[model samples]
Target: MANTVSAKKMTRKIAKRTAVNRSRRSRMRTFIRKVEEAIASGNPNEAVAALRAAEPEIMRAAQKGIVHKNTASRKVSRLAQRVKALVA
Candidate 1:
């Protein structure tokens, strides 16, 4: 129940922002899932390619505050290590 005009406007803005953030987060997850699927398939080259595609998106999500920086870094680190282990 937004009582004031300003509060109603703020609610509308929040709804719009929420939709945008949700889409961004979903896109990021899709990228991460692609990497995971590639890894699970045991194709190192495919995994590498997926990781290459996903890294920037993950970082972008972090930059946009969708995820924490360390969370992003840790995910990238772990995924990279898995890809490396697959390669080696």
Candidate 2:
């Protein structure tokens, strides 16, 4: 449906970007899930490690525009809190 050459190129670029964003989002979710699973398993050490690993991935996703900044911050904060509680 894109008659103009520019439009066709734009469509291609959008498709590429969408795939990259989807991959990034999926990877981020996987890291978050790892942290949640560790937490649920009640292993303070493993939860701490997973949270440490997930924090940077979440922040990177936010930096890359795949996720909102506040959402990333909130997730990191809550995960850290939960990890701390596990240690207590």
Candidate 3:
């Protein structure tokens, strides 16, 4: 459908970027899921550790524009609160 050479090149670039973004999104989700699983299991220590690992990944995704900063902050904040409550 892309007749122009430039259009073809752009299509190729889009495909590559889409693959990368998809992987990044999937990776971010996996980290978040780990934290949720830990929390659900009701193990404070494991949840803390998972949150530690997930926070950076969530922030990174936000930085990359995969997710909004507020969303990432909210997620981190809520998870941290739960982890803290577990400790108390």
Please report the candidate that would top TM-score against the real structure. 1
For lDDT, the strongest prediction is 1
TM-score of 1: 0.98
Instruction: Please report, as a residue range, the 10-residue window in candidate 3 with the lowest summed lDDT.
Output: 79-88
Q: Name the 10 consecutive residues with the lowest summed lDDT in model 1.
A: 78-87
Model 2: per-residue lDDT, tens digit, 48-72?
Answer: 9999899999999999999899999
Which 10 consecutive residues of model 2 have the lowest summed lDDT?
A: 79-88
Candidates in descending lDDT order = 1, 2, 3
Compared with the true structure, all predictions reach lDDT values of 0.97, 0.96, 0.92
Which candidate, 1 or 3, has the higher TM-score? 1
In candidate 2, which residue ranges exceed 4 Å CA deviation?
none
Can you give the TM-score per candidate against the true fold? 0.98, 0.96, 0.93
lDDT tens per residue, model 3, 1-88: 8999999999999999999989989999999899889988999999999999999999999999889999999988998998888878
Candidate 1: global Cα-lDDT?
0.97
Candidate 1: tens digits of C-alpha lDDT, residues 1-88: 9999999999999999999999999999999999999999999999999999999999999999999999999999999999999989
Measured with C-alpha atoms, the lDDT of residue 53 in candidate 3 is: 98
